[model samples]
Target: MTVVPPLTRMPHLRHVLAPVLAALLVATVIAVGPGSSPAAAQQAGSPPVVVRGGGWGHSVGMSQYGAFAQAKAGRSHGDILRHYYQGVNVGGANVPGEVRVGLLQNQPSILVRSSSRNGSQPSAPVKVNLGNGQIDVAWCGGCAPIDWAIAFEGGRWVLKDTSGAIRGEGGGPVTV
Candidate 1:
């Protein structure tokens, strides 16, 4: 007569049971359908399962190719911008000769020169001359003074301090 060993006493029984349990789990999942597991479905409703689709990148926002097609179909530049950017107004006017913009500390600034005749006559080049000492300015009447410095290096503008350490750098315009 043949004798069978109990599972606890049989060392090879674990190896055989592992594969059987795995196959049973796979079969149960296949029968239950994708994302239909009790835990997942209860945590969040079952989401749609996509099969096939074609897109170069993300689907959010306007497509550049669609904008190009609209332009080719006789839509103006402003029309294209307005369509892609909702709640936006597009308009243009002649440039002005001289315009002064108030500046703030550590903010980027821009200077624009235009030869259009829609505004005041062109004036001499604007300049900001700093002394050899460190720049000292206050934020408010009772605020403490802040020290800064400005210099031009390698065709770019640099803002530094008394220690010659660069605080900010850019080209195009000067910042206070």
Candidate 2:
């Protein structure tokens, strides 16, 4: 028999292995469809990939459980708030001004009203109308309307202008 070089000692080993490895990778990808976890796909009556976690409200800022733990560890309420909100002065002061309240409803309008500390006639109710996909800022006693065209880009809401310049962006509730 003619002496043949071993696969490891062959000059074209890389070329021979490249296509084989690529085919294997493609086959593996096809076998495991996108996000098809074995536990998720194999269950007889799985509840559609249910994710379980624990937390209340928006999960932002200080948590109630955290405060309870801190209090149990001999930390006071003031200490807890200070720890949660760093570099912030936690105190109350008396300021004299009319309290303005803006009530935003499910509809695209804000009912604006103001009331003074002392019993006085409340300001006339003003309805600030916001157009569809339009965010307005109260400026110079009028609404400065910014027409936003929002789109889902890269897994987040991207607020863009008519010229496609990104103005603002957020994944959750956007104030502006």
Candidate 3:
């Protein structure tokens, strides 16, 4: 069998261990409190000291303050990312032509309302029921309301007009 090098030499392992090592170091320093002997504090039976640290983001990844300082000192986006995250090659990658992001996950339903600009009255709100698979679409402003029935059938949402004809089939988002 061929011999393999240690996993610690891997870039991803190095990146993962660096933060853990830093946290352990900080914890050790705090446990052995500065300006006071640990034995003395234990003998006095004093309460645990609470130490507050600075910065706005979590310590699992790149530090917000560290990135801000780097940017203030004239660092590019790629430079910052490379500095924080190892095993990542920045730039020279193919970019996607289009990106679709799905929002409002786990929401039972959604209510949409029309607005009139410049201190005008708003129209009636339309309710889209996602959990039960039904939608009540509002037609126009100030006219007799026409309700269009839409339901989820066979894993796809089908929109039907007033005459009960299948207009279109969609997944989540519906357009009237």
State which candidate has the highest TM-score.
Answer: 3
TM-score to true structure, per model: 0.21, 0.22, 0.28
Off by over 4 Å in 3: 1-58, 109-176
The local lDDT score (0 to 100) that residue 54 gets in candidate 3 is 35
RMSD of each: 29.2, 27.5, 22.2
Which tens-of-lDDT digit does each residue in 1-176 have in candidate 3?
A: 96334232333454444443343343343222223333443434444322223334434456767877997999975676667665555554222222222133244423233334442344644555433355555456565445455665676666556676764555654443
lDDT of each: 0.41, 0.40, 0.47
Per-residue CA lDDT of model 1 for 1-176, tens digit only, reads 96343332324433333323333333344222222333433324433222222246634334668867997999976676556544445554332222222223244433222212344332332233222223222233333333455555666666564456764555534423
- Ranking of models by TM-score: 3, 2, 1
Which rank order by lDDT, best down to worst?
3, 1, 2
lDDT: the better of candidates 2 and 3: 3
Superposition error at 25 for model 3 (Å): 34
List where candidate 2 sits over 4 angstroms from the true fold: 1-57, 94-176
Single out the weakest 10-residue window by summed lDDT for candidate 3.
Answer: 93-102
